[model samples]
Target chain A: MTRIVFLGWLKEMAGCAERQVELPSLATPEELIAFVAGDNQSLAEQLAEPSIRMIINKSVLAGKTLPDTIEEVAFMPPLSGG
Target chain B: MIKVQSDIFDPGAELNNFMQGRTDMGAVVSFTGHVRGQNDISALELEHYAEYTETEIGKIEIQAQRRWPGIHTHIIHRYGKMKPGEPIVFVAVCSAHRQDSFRAATFLMDSLKTRAPFWKKEISGDKGVWIEPKASDYAAEKQWTNKV
Candidate 1:
């Protein structure tokens, strides 16, 4: 089980802050995106935009593959912080 | 002392507290960031993570002290809803000369704007928009990378 966190408008629209998704160890970012899309249509629509970023741990994650661990996965919109 | 508070601060008291028993400091430079009536299109309501904001500001102060010797710094940032003409943040740096104090104060403000986890919600025409960091702020921060 991996912790999937959301923030900002994503949190407001989904009406949820975080959730645990049970997936295999080698699940990729594409797989995670597909899973989220399958679970929540509103979040899927929001994440469809290119501005949204996927962060594993504190740093941003790029490419298709997921990390070895899913201890912290954050779906953050364009950071509006100063 | 570094503080991130929801309550308003008395500038007189803060200044006095920062300056007490500092006879050797020849110059004290301070910066007060106020909530202007107009932010792009609206008034602002600022919010911040209290613990994280204070910790980050304290780190900035430590970095400033390391860069310049014999400098004292104080930063106070207020969170929660703030109106126009109210103080948002106050940074005071004291040093033996005006140049060091002035530079340190400016550096602190620049770093705070970029690194601090503070957000502003601008209210315009009954709509609230969250303000993001401008390209200008990034441009300013870019100058510091080479210095370090």
Candidate 2:
């Protein structure tokens, strides 16, 4: 199971905080983003944002693999909290 | 120490407790972030990536420690709903000298402004808006020159 979590305005846009999807095996963050968006073009477009960051199971990943051990993937906008 | 909680805390007592039993410290710098009541803000809803908030904060803390050796750090960030005037975040650093502690505290806060995975949704009247990172904040963090 791959849980894709949303935050901030993205959460408001998604209408929920997270969505769980079953993956047969390992998947890239990009792949997971598309899978979670599915047919929602708006969500898909939002996920494409250059500012969007990917975190897999609590580690902020950059050009990194989402291995089979990964259980959650978070799509985050540029953080503003301090 | 990193505590990401919803409860309010007394900065004074917390500061005392953090420095307790540490006699090698000569200077301590603490910063408290409170919810602003400006613009008629009824409350500030803090949302965070539960799986990542603490880990990211811990990473940043460790980075600061590595950058400024011998500096001790404590970070407390609140999540969920909070009204105006309530404390939202706290950062304290203790070191043998003011310079090291000051730089470490500022570095921790500066990195946290943009590095941490927490966001604020400002609610006023009948509307709510997710706050974005200010350009000034990015600039401030940039002045650090050293990326965590």
Candidate 3:
């Protein structure tokens, strides 16, 4: 099981801040997001927006391989804080 | 030192506290971020990952240290609601030389502005909008990409 965390508006749209998902070993981050977006079309569209940012293991990631042992991944909107 | 709290803090006091017990330090640079009042922005609501905010700031601090040796970095950011003109963030860097401290403080601020998990929402009257990073912020952070 892996956990995906959401923040700010994404959290509000998703209705929860964090959730655990069990997926096939071959599942990709995109697939994970799709799974999370599940039956919510608006959520799926928002997740697909280009302005969103992804962080895996505390580092900002664009597109990268996800290690099997990865524990948590975060999805965020563009940061605005100083 | 890194902190993510909701209480109001005086940037001057925090700077003095950070400078306390230090005689070898010759240069100290501090930067404070305030909630801008333009465009009818009355307040700001900051949200962050309760577990990862400090750790993420710590990662930036470590990167700053690697970029500038012998530099001491301290970052404090407030979360939750804040009124206009209130302090939102404070970053101070102390080093033996002026150049290192100045560059390190700027580096820390630039990194934190983009890399930190904190998200800001500007409340203008009854309307609220999620703030977006400006092009200048990306340009500022890009200067450090060629290093390490």
DockQ winner among the candidates? 2
True contacts kept of each: 0.29, 0.92, 0.84
Residue B112 in model 3: shift from native, Å? 0.8
DockQ of all predictions against the true structure, Cα-based: 0.33, 0.84, 0.74
Model 2: lDDT to the true structure: 0.86
TM-score of 1: 0.74
Error of 1 at B89 (Å): 1.3
CA lDDT of A80 in candidate 1?
Answer: 37
Q: If the candidates were sorted by their TM-score against the true structure, best first, what order would they fall in?
A: 2, 3, 1
Comparing 1 and 2 on DockQ, the stronger one: 2
Candidate 2 wrongly placed segments (more than 4 Å): A24-30, A64-69
* Residue-by-residue lDDT tens digits, candidate 1, A1-82: 7777765556566667677878665567766776765777767878767777777765568877777777766676654333
Report the C-alpha lDDT of model 2 over B23-137, residue by residue, as the tens digit: 9999999999999999989999988887678888998899899998899999999999899889999999999999988888998899899888889889998799889899999
Assess each prediction's global lDDT (C-alpha) against the native: 0.75, 0.86, 0.86
